[model samples]
Target: MLRKGLILAAFGLAFVAGPAFASAGPKEPRQASWSFEGPFGKFDQAQVQRGYKVYREVCAACHSMSLLSFRNLGQKSGPFYDDKYPNPNDNPYVKSIAKDYQVNDIDSETGDVVQRTATSADTFPSPFANEAAARASNGGALPPDLSVMIKARPQGAQYVYSILTGYQAPPAGLEVPPNQYYNPYMPGDVSAFYKGKGHVPVGGFIAMAPPLEADKVTFDDGTKSTLDQQAKDVVAFLAWASEPKQTERKQFGVAAMIYLLIFAGLLWVSYRRIWRNVAH
Candidate 1:
């Protein structure tokens, strides 16, 4: 009877402590619906185009998308893809886009390296020459290459959207460190590092300042340039960049499932027919 009482008490204690423990971690990112979320979902082309604009006008200064080539902008699955530019290499718009940046190339006659207008074959260039330069520019925090950022994070697009919109002044009793801005969604907090130094509250901070603001970029489609709207558009574009073939893959999966279901039904019918004349 004593053992039973001890076990019951232990369980009661666990039941009481579970909620407290569960709430200890960083706040879970709020989930946002995506146009390309489910099996039947397809990306909204206009949103993707708007997202590309936001990336180009705002985020491009700090982030490099080295994995993507200029021609990728005209890909069939990409936001800027169009029937007119079936061959992205020869697309006039793609060529014009590439020309916006200067690329280093060796001169055919002189064999000397020279900066020239980029072509569709060229990948997007990094803003800084190297990691040292990047770190020097940003006060020791190296800006991450954004090519696969959405895939690299825990919640991908949702987490990014939260981070973009989550910046806030530290609460009344909390002390934020210099050069570090308060953002609850980012990992690591002032409290964790400042044990006994002061009354620093628990919430992560980031080095990159808030990049988005209202009316930062004029949308061609006339969509309101609210912070949330810009964040959503950019996240959608990043999602596409991470998995351009998502729609095709989902379509194939649906087709495969349908075929398997039909095949299974036929097999079951055949087995019953074949065993009809025999005893189990």
Candidate 2:
């Protein structure tokens, strides 16, 4: 996220300091650039499932993406397209999980309030009343709803992957000035929240330390336990989290592919017929 402000405003505007503070440290895991694409090596279905387990077991208590529905776990929707799509009903891994009641807000004459409903629908509930309230509740650190996080963050997959795996220290001789916030991915003190409390002044910085650890969530099959591996899994999960429309997109993609192939064949035949007479 980027921030704008006057020359002297410093950290008053949250945006300027938001990213810098958010990225105060390189606490995430390390990942390869290719993980952003589909069929990412080591970033497979199992890894995503494991990452989800980590979220549910460890992080969910503090952070909640109420907007996400259990049904979404079985679907695939994101920037990248892969053959392994989520199937809520058929997949044994997810089918056994019980669905729960979902709640939503209805704007009625009585004003804004929450109402519980079925969870089978595609909608989600907001975790907080608004941005300000959310930030206040979470120690001045708004735990962003993960439902659309993969989409909201620019180059979200890569960013999330980097964040997950970026917990290392800065290279030799790199010193964080007393006033400036420190981060690996963020370029400088540009974080808006330089003061005791404020938003991230830097554009690409965030303060929430990396949550996942190496081999934290081991799968049934033995796999190497490394931060990079964890990063791959978490990023895949986030990519799926961001887009729950994978099945629909894949269906459309197959149809488009067929149409293009048929069109190409027709063009080939037309060209042969048109040139046949000239050859004779």
Candidate 3:
């Protein structure tokens, strides 16, 4: 009884402190509901495709998705995947998309490196030749790759969506440094109250300007391309990119849970039967 009481006391204290600990972090990120959120959640294919369009037309100019390949885009789990094109390698649409980019390759006959039309097997190429060129073009700030961006950031998809839509005029009396844009969502300088305290700013002065705007990309599905809509869609796509197997993982988890419950029940029944003839 004493041990149980101590455990209950500890739990009570934890319950009381939970909100305090949660509030200690930097401002709470704006929450956005995603189709692929809960256990039974699934990706909205149309939104994913629209988001991909946004990434290709706008975000691709500065950011690189180095870890993704054209073939991955047509996998069964991908938004663009179609039963009609089961094999991404032979998919006509994938082939057409790959042909737009120039990839570096070794010449077959010349024995030298040359730029060739990209194939479905080729990974998405970087916009600039190297990091130096990328920095030079973007005023010394390196644009992060979007391959695992959803997984990389805290609060994942919601944080990204907030950052994309959070750009605004700095609050009164805050001096935003040159070349530094003000965004409440980006981990930047702290408020005046915590100036000299031990709290150091985590994220500040983002280099890339606001990338999304109203009607920035035309959606083939006829959805109005508002700023928030674009942010939501692209973040959804990034979430899928980061964890393509999320749905499968959840499905497996459900099965495992059911199995464990059944096993536990059987064990309990066997224990009761075996001890039925004996005394405690």
Candidate 4:
């Protein structure tokens, strides 16, 4: 307990220094329903799977989740988790997913760079080889990595959902520039676009165009593909990816609390017995 508390304290201190501390999205993220919200709440595996599908089909082309590997998809409570496969590396589903990706590797015998089929152990490869290339590909705007993005933002999940779904036509006379788009949820000062003395519009300029659309990616579960649905699903996957161990951590916390309660009760009973025969 002390160790966990210390770690949490250290984390809190670090967070105070983190960029997220000063986060200032133009508008508060629209709240959304989530399965993993409370202490005993758990992830909906089916929903996570659908979210992963959305990420793979749409987001993967531009964004990278390099902090995660294909094998993580098979970890306990993960999108492809299977009870029969105790180790994620052995999960057939994860293997199939990894096999589909072509990763850059060195040929051991020839000592040459080569494109090889990926394995479950490999991390998700970036779409671009370097930051410069990534920025160049997207009109000098680099796509941020999705790993830990949920933890890095305030109201993490809601913020991402709003950004994904909150795109709209630029407010009148905003004078949006080439390669830039306006989103009400994007964080930035748009006062420059407010020459007419209004509230500067409740948003900022973004390089990213609207990514999700209705029917963009078909869900295997036959769930209707609405713009809202796609945004929610992908956000869920990002939520899970942000902390793969969150469910396990919550479970451990519950067990620890229960144990502490039992121990405290026993100590109280012992103290009462010891003092019963003594005078005040």
Cand. 4 TM to true fold: 0.89
Error of 1 at 77 (Å): 2.8
On TM-score, the candidate that comes out on top is: 4
Candidate 3 pairs with clashing backbones: 187-203, 188-203
TM-score, one value per model? 0.83, 0.58, 0.80, 0.89
Query: Native-vs-model 3 lDDT?
Result: 0.82
Q: Which is better, 1 or 4, measured by TM-score?
A: 4
Give the 10-residue window scoring lowest on summed lDDT in candidate 2.
77-86
Q: Which should have the higher TM-score, number 2 or number 4?
A: 4
Per-residue lDDT over 1-280 for candidate 1, one digit per residue giving the tens place of the 0 to 100 score: 9999999999998877554333233557869999898898878889988998999999989899888888887887678788876898987878888989987789899999899899999998888888999999888999998888999999998899999999998766555666778887787745544333233444487889999999998899999999999999999988888777777788899999999999999999999999999987
What is the model-wide C-alpha lDDT for candidate 2? 0.56
Candidate 4 residue-wise lDDT at 26: 89
Highest lDDT: which candidate? 4
Candidate 1: stretches off by over 4 Å: 1-25, 108-112, 192-202, 273-275
Q: Residue by residue across 233-271, what tens digits does model 2's lDDT show? A: 656676667665654565677789999999999999999
Error of 2 at 258 (Å): 5.0
Pick the winner on lDDT between candidates 1 and 3.
1
Residue-pair clashes per candidate: 0, 42, 2, 0
